[model samples]
Target: MTVQLPPLPEIHHPKIQALFQKSDRELVTLFQRHPEEGQYFAAIFCRYGQVLYTLISTATRSPVQSDYLFVKTWEYIYHEMRVLDLRVTTPRLSLQSWLINIAAMMINRAEVPPVEEIQYSLKDTPPVFWCYLNQALNQMAGNLRLVLLLSQTFQWSHTRIAAYLHAEGESISASDVKQLLVRAYQALEDALPEDIRDIYLAQPAVTA
Candidate 1:
């Protein structure tokens, strides 16, 4: 598939190093304010680009399709971030998870050839389950919700989650990740309606 994508800023751009010092939220804020400044977004891409591409590529198993979705995902992020309120997205996810969510949305929207088997999208999900699950996740505290999304949606290790959180300015450890996940699971069960749980159990597992 031939696709059009905006060229990334030069790797040796002088601002890249300086922007790297800023955290994800900081870079997001900067990009929000100055949509014309590509460097801030570039730095964000540098931080998670490989993981994001890997996610899309892993799910697609087609480099051409992966490249198309990769570009589309960033294109979505480029616009979405402009109006994105960090406070109250449905899933209340961390930036990494949020980015992956965008990629998943894009992936699900694409027409997969009959030969391909995809994972980690809401494609086959029941609508009621989707709504209820979002509600359940949203009911949790920010840290717990973020931890659960990272752990369950992306299957990131506690150490990886802790390290990423620490880099984002939180003071946390792997022990904290495990403890929060325990609470998150309980919180999810309490937040979900019982009938929805029964319905979800009978369906194919939904992945983010």
Candidate 2:
């Protein structure tokens, strides 16, 4: 079947556009060699960090955790650069997607919002539960966290998430990703306050 691609959104910032043009290896090398280079990297992060963080935070529902995961993602990229090599034909999906995937994995490893606690939310009704739910998910590991963020917060399609994983050299099915995402959302809602549970539940499902 033929697929329809989304309209290309403009990356208007001249400086950031330049950064994106460089290979990941190049950017990482720059950051690693110069202690002061962090300031420059931070500028890049600051430019697009919110969009990335918001995508992550919404998926996991935690601002505090998103902050931590975001920083960790950059560090990992820097560390990976030491021995990593990318072929010219690598799958292309903007640098932000790459970073967001790392952030997601970090959240998954943390394993916050245990299955048992998720079930608890389905049973109880509390005021301002979504706040707590958001907090709990934020505490989870990066992978699961990013999955939720991209699927729920950014409203990306499961196919898109799958395509991203494939680009990163990870093998996962879009259907499998969708299943995990469903569980993540259920857990998130379970953790929310009963008062707004219906509202949260009623919100439109995320789409590409």
Candidate 3:
């Protein structure tokens, strides 16, 4: 069954609320004439950058690619917003969802380099584990992987993870976040190679 994402929050800050409330035409005009609006634009990036990185990292399974894609996505958005007709009538596709879909498409179409390019050489130690982890992470989607990394690697509290995912000012129930974390961990466990899986399973809890 598909999981339901929580509703997005409204901008509470008066300045931000005012910016968002402005017509698309107004925003485009400001962008073209003001140019220095980049200062205020940071507010949007500050709020969504981590979430976007989390999503792209899970999809690309490469930190380098994730970094690249995240930047590219924003650049694309900046360009598109400047030229967007802003007259669309689709009720279901908000700006966030539209950008997400574009990101997904860009990620899927991205070309993976040859194995040689991916090889990591270090002094005396093999990077095999990282390679395996990347492969396994790519098998899962962004949301699940975010849950896994936050819950397993970072050991963030369920309430915190829920707060990030929900985007709502209110925290989600701890039980709900716990369930999502469990499922993400299970998926990662199943995707891992047998040898690596055993090692990961045998390891003690990761320190916060």
TM-score of each: 0.48, 0.34, 0.38
By lDDT, the best candidate is: 1
Descending-lDDT candidate ranking = 1, 3, 2
TM-score of 2: 0.34
What's the CA error at residue 186 for candidate 1, in Å?
Answer: 59
- Per-model lDDT: 0.68, 0.52, 0.55
Model 1 scores a TM of 0.48
* Each candidate structure's count of clashing pairs: 0, 24, 0
Model 2: per-residue Cα lDDT at residue 63: 41
Strongest candidate by TM-score: 1
Clashing pairs in model 1, backbone N/Cα/C closer than 3 A: none
Q: Where is model 3 poorest over a 10-residue stretch in terms of lDDT?
A: 1-10
- What is the lDDT, from 0 to 100, of the residue 61 in candidate 3? 61
The residue-by-residue lDDT of candidate 1 on 26-135, one tens digit each, is 98888788743455666777677667777777777665556656655776676687788767987687888888888888888866544344342322442223444665
Instruction: For candidate 2, write residues 1-208 as lDDT tens digits.
Output: 2222122122233433556766555664564565322323433444455555555556555444444444445455545534433443267545565666666777677544533333222113211223335555766657777889888667799999988888888898999898878777777656543423433234555899
